[model samples]
Target: MRVRGDDLVKDLKKLRKGRGILTSSIISHVGPALGEADCPLSDRELEILRMVEEDRTATDIAYALHLSAGTVRNYISSAMTKLDARNRAHAVRIARDQGWI
Candidate 1:
């Protein structure tokens, strides 16, 4: 079975957290590296934004991602709010500029 990158990352984080002292030591050394790797937007937000960058409609993106169109729109709206974008196009542009997608 194929696990998504987001799921794998979350699983690794869970495993690291279970290690207590080791995780703390690693976090101390890792510092900003971990912070930088953490996306300001959630995985679903990034995925939908990237699709927008490809000029896909909300319906198209929803179909591709196996989500409802409304759900996809909500994610896009949330991403726009987080990025302070004027619209979906602007959000995609900002995300691309930040290398978020």
Candidate 2:
């Protein structure tokens, strides 16, 4: 199950050529042995979740980001759905645990 260093480098080169960004995409080079296969949250979702982790309310986040409170709530909801989290607190915990925020 050990991959040679040269093989790993070659795989990485191929991956870099085929896929420019690693975000929102799974890298099969290492496979499931690394952990979960996908990161579904977008950058906006991560940003909102980071604010949530800091105990910021949707309204507070909205003011800080110059977005509507409803928009902030929507971002939190989207992140929660992606993370399969039950609430804002849960979403924060999941994101933190996964090192996504």
Candidate 3:
């Protein structure tokens, strides 16, 4: 593309102006990532809670996820600690309330 010198400056300014506009749609599209910015749980811990939401036992989740039941329990314990939850059920509820699972 070729343009007169004046047209080149005009096009450059237009592009810069467009880049400056951060629309709500853009933010909403990026909401999931930004939402977790303050989240204290690890990704693995979050994954465990999500499975916990499905009423899956640690052994069941471990079998499906190929992790040990002990590992799954560890993740749940960590998530509970981070969320200040009293137990597995509370952890799942807190995670759901925070939109983390």
Q: In terms of TM-score, which candidate is strongest?
A: 2
Instruction: Return whichever of 1 and 2 wins on lDDT.
Output: 2
Please give, for residues 1-101, the per-residue lDDT of candidate 2 as tens digits. 23566866766676789953442212333535677555678999999999898888999999999999999999998887776567889878766656677
Clashing pairs for model 3 are none
Model 2 lDDT, residue 90, Cα: 80
Model 2: residue 81 alpha-carbon error in angstroms: 0.8
Identify the runs in model 1 with alpha carbons over 4 angstroms from their true place. Answer: 1-38
lDDT by residue for model 1 over 1-101, one digit each (tens)? 23466755565587677843322223223534657434468988998888898899999998998999999999999987776567888777766755677
lDDT string for model 3 (12-98, tens) is 565578843322222223335567435678888988888998999999999999999999999999877766577899878766755
What TM-score, over all chains together, does every model reach?
A: 0.61, 0.64, 0.62
lDDT of 1: 0.71
Clashes of 3: 0
Question: Residue 56 deviation, candidate 3, in Å?
Answer: 0.4
The superposed Cα distance between candidate 3 and the true structure at residue 76, in angstroms, equals: 0.4
TM-score of the candidate numbered 3?
Answer: 0.62
Clashes of 2: 0
